[model samples]
Target: MKKYLVQFKPFLIFIGTFFATYILLTLIYKSYLNHFESDDVDEITRIVGYNVDLLLHAFNSDVFIQKSVSNPWLEVWYNNDYVIRIVEGCNAVSVIILFISFVIAFSRKFKTTFLFILSGTLFIYILNIVRIALLAILLFRYPEKVHLFHGVLFPLMIYGVVFALWVFWVNKFSKYAK
Candidate 1:
C-alpha cells in the first residue's frame, strides 16, 4: 500500500491541484455572476457578446450590423436579413478555466506560471472573440451548414488552441518536462 501510494503521489497531486483550482475559479466566477441583473445570463457572457457584436460591426459597417445588445442578450444582424445570437457557452470562460487548471497541475516556477496563465488567458479570450465574430460571419455566409460549422468546426478550433497551448507549456516551461 505504501509503495503504491508513493508511486502514484505525483499523479495524485496533479489531479488534486487541477480540481482545486478549477473549482475555486468556477466558484469565484459564479459569485461574480451573482451581481448581474439577468437571471438567465451572466455579465461576462454579455460582455463577450457585446465585444463580438462591436467587432463584427467595425469590420463591415453595411453588412454585419449589430441589431441590439443593450440587454443581456446579443443579436447581430447580417445584411439586415439574418441574425446571429451569442449565448453563454460562446463566452469561452470555461475553456480558459480548463486551460488554467491544467497549467496549474503542471506548474513551473511561480512567476513563470503566473505570467503564462495571464498571457494564455488573454490569448484565449481574444481568440474566442474573433471566433464568435467569424462564426457569425460564416453562419451569415453559409446558413445551410450551420451544424457543421457551429457544432463541430468552431469547437474543435477553440479546443485545439487550448491543446496547443498546453503542449507548448509542457514542452517548454513545465517542471516535469523531459
Candidate 2:
C-alpha cells in the first residue's frame, strides 16, 4: 500500500542504492575480467605489495628481495631468487570489498555511512599493507607454498574477518536491522 511504501521509503532507498551499486559493479567487474587486461592496476598493486613486503622483511627476518621484475605485460612478478610471486590483484579486490561490505553493514545514515566507509577504507588500506607484508614473508620463507599462501589462505582469512564484522554490525550495530 502507499502508506506502507511511504513508511519504508528511506529503508527502500538504502537497499536500492546498495544493491544497485553492488550489482552494477559486479557486472562491470566481470566484463573487465573477461575482456580487458587489467595488468596495469595489477602491476601497481604488485609494486605496492612488494614495497610492503620488503619493509616487513626488514623487521629482523631473513626475507630478501634479490631481484624483482615489474612485468607490465601480465602483472607477473618474479623474484630472481623465488619464481612466480603471487599477483596483487586479488588482494586489492579483497581489501576493497571488505570496506564496502563494512560500510553497508555498519552505517545507517549518509553522514555515518561516509565516515564509517572512510574509516573502513583506511582499515582496508592498512590491512592490505599487512597482507602484503605477510605475503612477502611467506613467499620468502615458503616459496613453494605460494599457491596456498597467496591464492587460497589469505583471501579466506580476510573474507572471514569481513564476514565476522558484518555479523557484528547487523546484530549489534545496525539500527535498521533492529
Every model: Cα RMSD to truth: 2.4, 5.2
Give the per-residue lDDT digits (tens) of candidate 1, residues 4-101. Answer: 98999999999999999999999988788778666356767767867776787787644443324465556667678655776666788889999999
The TM-score values for the models, in the order shown, are 0.89, 0.62
Residue 68 deviation, candidate 1, in Å?
6.8
lDDT of each: 0.83, 0.59
In candidate 1, which residue pairs clash? none
**Which candidate achieves the best TM-score against the true structure?**
1
Candidate 2's C-alpha runs over 4 A off are 1-15, 23-47, 50-54, 57-70, 73-80, 83-91
Candidate 2 lDDT score relative to the true structure: 0.59
lDDT (tens digit, per residue) of candidate 2 on 81-122: 443344545346545654575456446777766665666566
Clashes of each: 0, 0
Which residue pairs clash within candidate 2?
A: none
Alpha carbon lDDT of residue 68, candidate 2? 35
